[model samples]
Target chain A: MTTVPVRPPLVRSSDRIIAGVCAGLAEHLGWPVRMVRIGMAVAALAGGAGLVFYGWLWIMVPTADESAKRNARRPASPIAPAVSIAPAVSMPPNQSAAVGPSLWSDAYSPGYPSGPVAPPLGGPAAAGPVGYSSAANPAPSGPYVAGAPSQAEGTAAVPGTGAWFRVRNMRYGKEILLGAGLLLVAAILIARLLGVEVPLGTLIPAAAILGGAAIAWMQLDETRRAGLVDKTKADQAGGWARLAAGLALVVAGVLVMVSGSGSWEQTWLALLASVAVLGGVALVLLPWGLKFWRDLETERAGRVRETERAEIAAHLHDSVLQTLALIQRRAANEHDVVRLARAQERELRGWLFRDPARDAGQLSDRIKAAAAEVEDGLGNAVDVVSVGDTAMTDRHEALVQASREAMLNASRHGGGPVSVYLEVSDGGAEVFVKDRGSGFELHTVPADRLGVRESIIGRMKRHGGSAEINSSPDGTEVRLKLPAAAEDNGEGKS
Target chain B: MSTPALDGTAGDPGRTVRVVIVDDHAIFRSGLKADLDPRIEVVGEAGTVEQAIEVIGRTRPEVVLLDVHLPGGLGGGGREVIAGSAALRGTTKFLALSVSDAAEDVVAVIRAGARGYVTKTISGAEITDAVYRVAGGDAVFSPRLAGFVLDAFGTAPADIADDELDKLSARELEVMRLIARGYSYKEVAKELFISIKTVETHVSAVLRKLQLSSRHELTKWAAERRLL
Candidate 1:
């Protein structure tokens, strides 16, 4: 009933700053990873839900591609676990489990456990196939977890019970400070619940101190992850403004908490007033903020589509438009006339429709490279369209060499656009080089001028191929043909 | 918007063709009109989407020299104009024009019901010939467009998509490849030992097959290439 079987695996990513719990979550939820991180930080600091949740994920979630392969190899694991251990994890097992977040459960529920313990079953609700959701927490038990999927068995394997208590990576300083603050938060909350006379002023600033500490802790985590410690200036919060503000907020919170009982009425009034003002400000700036981000995204999308045309438009001004201005000033020479037309053609073809990726295979690539050489030095543009190709063969030499000569001659005499079309099939390979120059009679060309013509024709003839030259006032087409390969010829004889 | 004065070329072959120029460049549009064969009358001109659609709808010219890129109405370009002129598809034909043999925009316009496209680098006489061909119920496929079409349809008839209309006849494949290899209709005819008209028919049939395919290999090929 669900597309759960088709969904991507719920794996923790290596691209992480903290445990990658929120980052992986953000990807699946289509929320900004930053927002998810902040939300988790808040969740962790305020109630310790996020910290427990993240540690549980860190132990349960596989690190990357390695775990996915392991999951694929374990056949029949999901079924036995579903039958034997389904009831173990499904706390308060009921029909409600089947109904809520069905898609979410489907992805995670089916995963086989990484540990030596028999793979844990999904919630009892998902019957036909295991549907695992983050909500499907395994009943806490001994010997169920091996080390996290990241570490090998021989390494310092994390014991199952202590997995939630992180001791490695020695973030000793911040860890102690945050641990004490969380203890203080728990103490305050417990005292209030026990009717231990905790005042509203103490509670408010106490919460502030913990929140500020959490924000700073996360920022420090990001910095250390970036490997910018001690060298790169504090820049994430716009050059030390954020870190200082965070530290200052923590200090101010401490001071306010120590100064002791302010009027409860005054604190409530100030809190409501600040809430209203910030709400009004957010409402006022919301449209502009949305527009700013939207405009940035729209510009990024347009940049790709408009790049070719924009380059052409920019070059049209740089070359062709400037050439017209030069032509007007020069009152004309042959060079200027030809230059103007060439510039225009360059502006049209070079800037506009030329896709360098158009060429494929050895023959087309070599022929195009030859054309590029002529165009770069002599300034004649060639358009090449290739249909099919074969692997490189000895027969390629006559075809490529003849095509190059035809191209050079076409540029020299044709003095206009040249086009080459290459087609290779089982029968044979053929290349057509057509030039838009006033045609020449092949025989009328004197012997001395016949070098290129004789070379093209004679080279093809020598290689068991043939060349045809058709010239007219309109254009000239050099037809070069290579017979099919030796294997095909041998087959015909047999 | 503008409509240029036309000097009747009654002596020229066949009837005079009425065409609307829809390029955003005023200079190129004017120069093209000025240099075009006398047999083609410049019926109207426009530089943006609204004007092109308005001009085309008002004049209902026999052929529209539609620019593949435009500056208005969500930047749909020539495809947008062709889409706007959907009602006039029977009466008016679209001949796409662009600076290069830009495959996507040309394919977009063609898929949006344009007959075919020619690059701006073509000779004035050739453009006139293309316009005449469009007006006479023929499509213009430049060598570049032919190359693109050939590539788009080159994959074997996928047994995966069983639509009969998506298949091209052997004659059409031969015609398409020849055209892609820069063979003019006459040359292709001579090479294949068929009449020039038969080559035209095969070319038209290839375009029709591509247009008729709602979902198939050709559509998938073009979809993968959809900067269109």
Candidate 2:
């Protein structure tokens, strides 16, 4: 008895067809499999109930191994009955010990067990209380005469125990109601078309009322299902309900107008009234519906954009900015410094403006190229040293341009061996262009001389960075700092 | 490169002003050396801060033509040369020469004890006369640079109170400027020689202190305060 309570009903593995419902049930109940199949076929022929019941049982019942697996996974609830009905007749030795306490409890318990009482009837009557109580009490429990009295008494009280209400609250309740309503409407329509004088006025109104009631009930059910305590979500769902109600009203109005038979003027008047009602409802609700939909769309789009921005920011922070900072700190000479600056600029520009992605070639190679260019033009020795790698290829062009200008300044003005150092770090990159020549005054450069102004300072400014020229009689060192990330557009001026 | 002949017609070697060209680039040095009038004698040249100090100290020239931004120091550039070679402040007049025309650069070297600041674009004759004037103990700034020196060292009252900026530490202020300028946390850390985590901490502290929400707001605040 305890074993039966623990295990769910199992489908027989050695089945004929359609999941072996009749066979599995016959074996479980100790009935002849042929007799059960013949009864099922007779019920199915009478209507579709037996087929539907078989399909439902096929889906609900697990195989022996599956039942065992489910039992192992599921913990028994304290309120569940200790004795199961099947084992009482099938396995007698275990029955008495398990059945004793459960039989006593069943006789006294207020709420009768609903699970084991409904499977015997092979039609729509399975859901009906009359069939459940009558069939469950009389036949199977007869073998255990002592236990039969308590079992029969327990099942007898089940119908009045609000069992139907419990069933109605199940997740599929709305679907079942919708299917029934549609079937009812189809049946009525078919009956009318077959020349039966059906009352359209009452029937159509009744259908509309039923649909509206179902929608309202479903909305409330869904609200409870979602566990949304907040009013806003409930209100949103209510908006949907209102929209449904408006549609149902329009449908009801059309049905009434179609079913009416009167003078031409009277019919025209009725049509006008129906149209005005629909227009009024549409006028009142359409803007609100559109606004609600638009708000939801904008909110979703905003969330997506924000997430994308955060992702981009995190990527840049980890890779590009870090490398640029390192480069800024370690760069050794004008050429290498310029190259790093260029690379940094390009990276920033690309990031801010959403330019096409570029391959971040080796930082060392870029520095070398910058050094080579400077060395060629200035006829000066430039040493390049760089450490680390970064995949930031945004504003490199502007940085490189500024760096070239700084190098040009060094070669043209400072006039000696220039050393270019490239330092990349976590935050930004710095390029130091050092010249072993005379340093001059920054403020003394003529306004018309745009090399330092436009090429170095202006370019850096445009790229959202700064250029610092530290010059003295000892030597001039131009330090270019390019941040890893920058705003897309420059602020008017700094 | 062969050194060009200094014009002998200007003055005798003994009576000429002994000047040392302290530029880092050799080509410019040689060109300046060749172009200088005979009155201003090119005695020595040095590329970096250490070399500049050593060369200027050894020659003890009347005037040292200093490049504003010299390398080979602890990132101090030309200012370090002036600060390091403080011993020759009165004896040898230091005239700064560079391509930068930023007022901050001009003021920095001047504050470091340079006699004058001049851009490298000056004609060779003008530089020679400027060197002569500097050597003679007269301040010799380029025409445009004179305004920068005055503005930097001016006695005018500040347009805005410093109280707001005084709320932050130097490091915090540095971080704030970078953040306000749209530098990422990592970039700020690199610029300040700190960790990204530290940069984040500083940024948070700045935002908290300023009662601002984000970097965007901070930038707007800084711009409004003219801190950028």
State each model's TM-score restricted to chain B: 0.87, 0.60
Off by over 4 Å in 1: A1-214, A217-331, A334-369, A375-381, A388-402, A413-416, A423-430, A436-476, A479-494, B1-12, B155-164, B223-228
Model 2 misplaced stretches (Cα beyond 4 Å): A1-494, B1-14, B150-228
Which candidate should be chosen as best, given TM-score against the real structure?
1
List the candidates' TM-scores in order: 0.54, 0.24
Error of 1 at A209 (Å): 4.6
Q: Quote the positional error of residue A141 for candidate 2 in Å.
A: 99
The digit string of per-residue lDDT tens for model 2 on B59-147 reads: 99888888887778786778888787788778887888876554456655765667666667556866776676556554443323322
Q: A40-148 in candidate 2: lDDT tens per residue?
A: 9888887887888788777766776776764453232111111222112222234335434444233323222222222111111121221112221223223333343
lDDT of each: 0.63, 0.55
